[model samples]
Target: MNWYVVYTKPKWEKKVAERLNQIGIECYCPVITQIKQWSDRKKKIEGPLFNSYVFVQLLDMDRNAVFQVAGVIRYLFWLGKPAIVKDEEIAIIKKGLSDSNVSDVSVTAFQVGDRIKLESGVFSSQNAIVQEISNTHYILVLESLGCVLKIKYK
Candidate 1:
């Protein structure tokens, strides 16, 4: 078993993960907890850590079992190929799951106008100015500290 990055269609991370799990293939779709505020109440919800990718473990399974999953785009790769993930790291992750509050760890879509706050590390106070956006994390300009901090959009 390994952590192979699975490409999925838009808004289909959960669907793909579910389908893969149904086939006896283990999958890890990391998610983050979010709090939504309404008129008078705040509710917490879980969302994907990565917007369009999820991890899965495959064995001698036929391609039909994989390609048939709903919303599956393909395995992430270069030169138009399916890239395989190694097993050691996957074991590390599984170990962490044994005793941690592991959230769905996926890529985050950091966009403009998204308000953010410092959660930890050096500049854990001053507001984070979203200077740039990327696939995995957001590049923030910490004005108070006079340095740029690239924080994972967790």
Candidate 2:
């Protein structure tokens, strides 16, 4: 059996994985737990690491069976064929997400000349160029306003 990638409906990764499992199909959905803060309180919740995508290990005969499950959109194709994922790649993804300190995993790595946007705070929605990186802050040069701001890394 080989691992193949399947696309699911929006926010339906878990549900689709469950349905596939119930039908005796093996599937893997990598998720991570994070603390979500709201105005009233904070709660730790599990969310998909790869949004709307799930991996399934199966034979060629089971292809149609997987598609029949609810919330399953279609198979992820590459170069006119269904993309086959390597077992080692999937294992690495699972192991990385299973770590206790997954929160420290940087989703995006910025370089010296990369363009980045401030997601929150006073400079929210503003674009800036990465100039330097200190141990605790990012020195970004905002060319539009002609100012350099050293924003603390969250």
Residues 1-154, candidate 2, lDDT per residue (tens digit)? 8999999999999999999999999999988777889999999988887888999999977788898899999998865688899999999998887777766443556889999888987888889999998767889998888999997643
Please give the distance, in angstroms, between residue 97's alpha carbon in candidate 2 and its true position after superposition: 1.8
lDDT of 1 by residue, 111-141 (tens): 7756678876777767777888776667887
How far residue 142's Cα lies from its native spot in candidate 2, in Å, is 27
How well does each candidate superpose onto the true structure, as a TM-score?
0.53, 0.67
Q: Where does candidate 1 have its weakest 10-residue lDDT segment?
A: 102-111
Q: Every model's Cα RMSD, please?
A: 8.4, 11.7
Task: Give the lDDT of residue 152 in candidate 1.
Answer: 63
lDDT of 1 at 94: 54
Query: How many angstroms is residue 47 displaced in model 2 relative to the true structure, after the best TM-score fit?
Result: 0.7
